[model samples]
Target: MEKQFVLMDVDRNVYEVDRVLNAQTTNIRSFGSEWSIRLQRLHGGLSDGVDVVWVDNGCTRLAILPTRGMGIWKANVAGVPLEWHSPVQRPVHPTFVDQSRRGGIGWLDGFNELICRCGLGWHGAPGTDVTRDADGNVVSEQFLPLHGRIANLPAHSVTVEISDDGAISIVGVVDEAGMFGGHLRLTAQLTTYVGSNTFEIRDTVQNLSAGSAEAEMLYHCNIGRPFVGEGAKLHIAAAEVAPRDSRAAEGISDWPTYTGPVQGYAEQVYFVRPLTADDGRALAVLAAPEGDRAVAVRFDTSTLPWFAQWKNTQAEADGYVTGLEPCSSFPNLRSFERQQNRVVQLDPMGSVTFEFAVTVVSAADDVSRLVQEVADLQQAERMTVHDQPNPEWSP
Candidate 1:
């Protein structure tokens, strides 16, 4: 088989990997395998900066990049913001859904159960919804109401490639029966603008059969290290947070009120706004402890409108972090909703395309200038207030 991605060696660790077209061998004995170090460089070629790198035993994703849920490890983006942790590793051999366990830190506990046993990573949604026993005592806990994940579907793995222009692109595909089946692709291109780093990703669904199929897609990211921490705080441009369980009578209607300086959220996910104030852009911001750098995740509300905010409430034993995810659908919850026509409809032969852009910036990056532009969008004179569609439910 042709090689898909690159393998790296920091000091002296022994590992086997294939870069682009050829298989390569490298040693990293200096940094013991126990370090949990995993990093990728789209360099030693045309670019100077590394694309995405994870350190401390994959406890943290050091750089900026897109992450799909890995079975047994926590993937972090930066130091403080987003973490993707899976304690349960998918079964390696049988390749079928069966109740089993393996001898590793990451092992499959059950169907869709990927727990993070350890690290500074992002904790995922627990599989069982509301587990009630015969006696009606809830045996299991529900993490998020509509969380969804795309794993092992035929070509569902993530792909990163370099263009001849020295620009690198990363794409994640989610399709029917992937690892090969028809899939949905979300692509991102890393480029620079006026001395700053900027990237954009496009979401497209491709049907593989002559007949039609239903498709849903989302871009999941893990941000941690260097950028996230305990003192870190989140600043969002949203006007409100939608109630995930509006069906609950006592559940607050329009449940999440946008209180300025929302704080102390760990392992919490909220459906939020994609509002552009006076100007014409929507922004989500997080301020970390170091340098008080405010990492801003800004996007064009017109393309991808939904955003989600997550924090680490679980103990470190879960190996997760505080995360702010901008997704197209609530994790693992899309399929059921789409079945009820809650998210949207897709004809067998038809497809929908959207885009999301994230810019990691410091608090001094002139956010006030961009915020002014966004504020202008809020005051548009010709628009009706109630006519507004809800800010995307998934960020």
Candidate 2:
């Protein structure tokens, strides 16, 4: 027998090699060894029975609570905390109360990372109004809760996805509706990418009813501790800054600076109209005292045309926090806002979208760059006095 020179299958051998090479290349490009998502359920503490999705992308870690209206429970960049936690230690589930018992400072007990999503009919205070019930019977003292119910309501149909490019996204839908009230739905998506120190929030508020609905939205992004104590500074590209009240006006000259916790410092609030860049976006930053660390927010001003700075540097026991809020309108009562023509109205089947991103600046060069940007904005226009004529109230 001739030395069995088995005829070499050239085409078959080439195809096998090509397939293996292609697979290896794809895996190398798509696999993120350091990024992962973990879903966990809490058993004790305020988080008991709460389901959280933790996303870690090597550079940043975020804990998203689906049971808490998809609000972020905690976030950190490179082991540095980025959010403020209230004195109230427990995470209260929305099921604990209905609209009657909810609203007001009572909602602040579990405030962590962020809260105070005001919307629908009312926002700032617990207002009592008379309205017709479904049966056409008049009901008096119908209460509209503080900050609305979106923050406390749980998200339905929550989904988390990880893309081949190592981006993680969490999406959910929250509904705040009643039998004879405005029907509103908030569809939210939170996204971050591997090895990146930034995270983005994209939300769409839709009026699901057949009639026009009044809505307000505010993102109370809070900062505390090392990022908000004495020596820390706030930078905003704002065209105007109006003190919300006489108290805020008292310290209007020092609005950009922060001080150590005062024994009884009344919180100061400033209403800001940010200056839009050529791209129609606005930037704000809160820097550490040393200026080595900073948290910056970039948002589209077309949708969120208003900004509020909340300074609550009272003694620690009383709570020390700073809030950078981007909103559709001032945090006034819905009735008051409507009178000012400041409230946003969504037409039947209409929707509004808001986009914002938060990023940590840790590098010295990046921090310097941010400081320069703030300086440029400060020189462009002096802070505007909050004296816009309003029939509802005067500051």
Candidate 3:
């Protein structure tokens, strides 16, 4: 008698059949009740010359794009969306653009995932500047890309490892260095376990030059509709909250609440310096007002000390997205950051590591527990700062 066996795919869809017959007709390899990672190319609508590393561990599924600097393009937990996507429709190659117009906004048009990395030189625009070329010749009117080129640069060495114990990880190294510019190297790794709803990201950025280099880094984790809509709310334990600019200050009072999309609604950015918990980690959550479903992001405050909340509630046709960002400093022009002494500097051959985890909360009891955790954190003592320093009366 032929033995009967069960098979499962990344979506958790299962099938039962005779093991011998199935093995004879298909390429089936038993992982011994373990998770699997498949490396394949995304074709047709999904492709613009990119390779995807797909992972599923029963509880969650992830699509990682190596050509896009290994950024997670999409993720889900038990069929529930865990990340926001832009209206770009398809993934585009990094070099498909004219050199004159390549920047953060250009890249943003293609894919906006749970995370988009920003900066080795700049995170925001500060206009043109004077710089020296590789030959030590002074060059003027040199403008850095909106968020640097790290995200658009493809990974050089990629490795995906899976263990017998049902553990899997993908590692990749991306270089964003130039002849006369900062030599920055990003080594990123992501790990997940079988049957776990949580995954972790560990990244190390190193300055591989002989001189100290200025750096800025931000993880643009976006949460959107269904998970971030009317009645959805954000809970964070922050010591201080400051508006990114005058535009954000207009909606300062309603920073933690969600509202329906408004016509001509501009984006608002709030800087949150969270109060670290006992383990030196800061917790933030976005939950549906009426459901047990929620998403949580936890990171070490020692490395990522600042968090930025980006609220974009424009017309539905355009996009309604919220960004939960954790970074070494605020998202500002590199020059301004240097003026404020907030720029991160790496000595020659120096490196810094950051770790963060995204977990899915699906149980009502667990959701309640997280709500309480946020409340407790809010009650903890904190240093307050003035939301606005310079206020001008506008008639």
Candidate 4:
């Protein structure tokens, strides 16, 4: 039998768990065989009123924040840290994240997370989103902020599930609703096993309104330092590779390679159409400088069909990190992505599922195998590496 704890159920007025896991512990007899789950309320600083759920499964550690869209703030696998050094050093409460600030890019203030989900309404570049009458005259226009509002919204319902077998799951539901924005609910679950080097994030975005709705999502899996410094490489099997702009064109020749932090290096992004396996699985890996260790992402392309390699190797003080993003579409503005047929449409009360797994390779042998897997997928198709930006894929 499995034990379930409700951490927050807004409709039922159940707000806190108050250290329930501390009172009830679980144990096994192999591979370190221990798991500890803790829920803590942060006080003071920018994290005021924030709730964090920590799941330490012997070999791995996860910091999941329900207050900030149920994002996994950071994680550790087999003693190796899988996180970037963002300017925001802590898990910022939604109250501190101002999406409308900075002319629109204010989302960067709370941008540091191992897996920060973007979108529920619109996850794309900031721009003017317009709607027109049947005859094409503009009816309404608004400035859509960057990456939507899911990451800055709190989950209304959260639960922790622990099976007698020692597996762990953290479930959260974040709602994006307003008089003007309609209603969309994101039911997310993060699951892992004791002493395992892998974990999975499963999300189902639902339309909770009486009418149809639009949704977008991207998993911004950011990594830095040990897994992303000099000599690092990004492995992916893509049928097409394109630079986002002229700036990214400068590095198109060495798209998969990385260098140490440079003081004035501007950010560059490459959009890829990864080739999916027969099972609809897409793989991307970021290998360490030594090539003996790495982190891999396996996603189902039936839902997330685009991949973005975000290169921001700026100085350490300025936040040096890279992102291996698996997304439903490129990070172009919502209007632009919709024109490219990238935005997803949902019927009333309909939903879509996005599933992906993150695994860390602690051994040199496993790293080689994963890299080979990417190569095998690529060889099946002729890859088109565009020297400059692909206007069709970029804004």
Separately for all candidates shown, the number of backbone clashes (residues 3 or more apart, or on different chains) is: 86, 0, 0, 0
Q: lDDT tens digits, residues 1-395, model 4? A: 77788878999998765564632343323334667778789999998888988888888999999999999999999889989888888888888888889989889888888899999888878989886677989887889999999999999999888776667889999999999779999999999987889999999999999999889999999999889889999999999999999999999999999999999999999999999988888999999999988999999998999999999999998889999999998888877787788889999999999999999987899999999999999889999999988988997
Tens digit of per-residue lDDT, candidate 1, span 153-255: 2222444343333233434343333442333332222222212234454555544444545444434444444445555555565655653332311223322
What is model 1's C-alpha RMSD?
11.8
State which candidate, 3 or 4, has the greater TM-score: 4
Candidate 3 residue runs with Cα over 4 Å from true position? 1-34, 44-46, 98-104, 129-141, 163-165, 382-395
lDDT of 3 by residue, 1-395 (tens): 11222222223453221122122242333334335566665556546567666777777889877777778887888778776656665566676633235443565545566677777566755455444467867664566556667667777666655555555677878888888876889988888877788999999989999999877888888878667888788889888887777888888778888898787999988888888888888999888767587888899988899888889888776677888888887776665565566678889999988888998877778877887898897788664644552221100
Residue-level lDDT of model 2, residues 14-102, one tens digit each, is 11111211113333243444665555666776667676667777789887776777788778888888767577655566665355554
Error of 3 at 158 (Å): 1.3
The parts of candidate 2 lying over 4 Å away from their true place are: 1-33, 97-103, 128-142, 377-382, 386-395
lDDT of each: 0.38, 0.72, 0.72, 0.89
lDDT of 3: 0.72
Candidate 2 residue 55 C-alpha distance from true site, Å: 1.1
Give the best candidate by TM-score.
4
- Pairwise TM-score winner, candidates 2 and 4: 4
**TM-scores, each model vs. reference:** 0.52, 0.84, 0.84, 0.96
Worst 10 residues of 3 by lDDT: 15-24
Query: Higher-lDDT candidate among 3 and 4?
Result: 4
> What does candidate 3 score on TM?
0.84
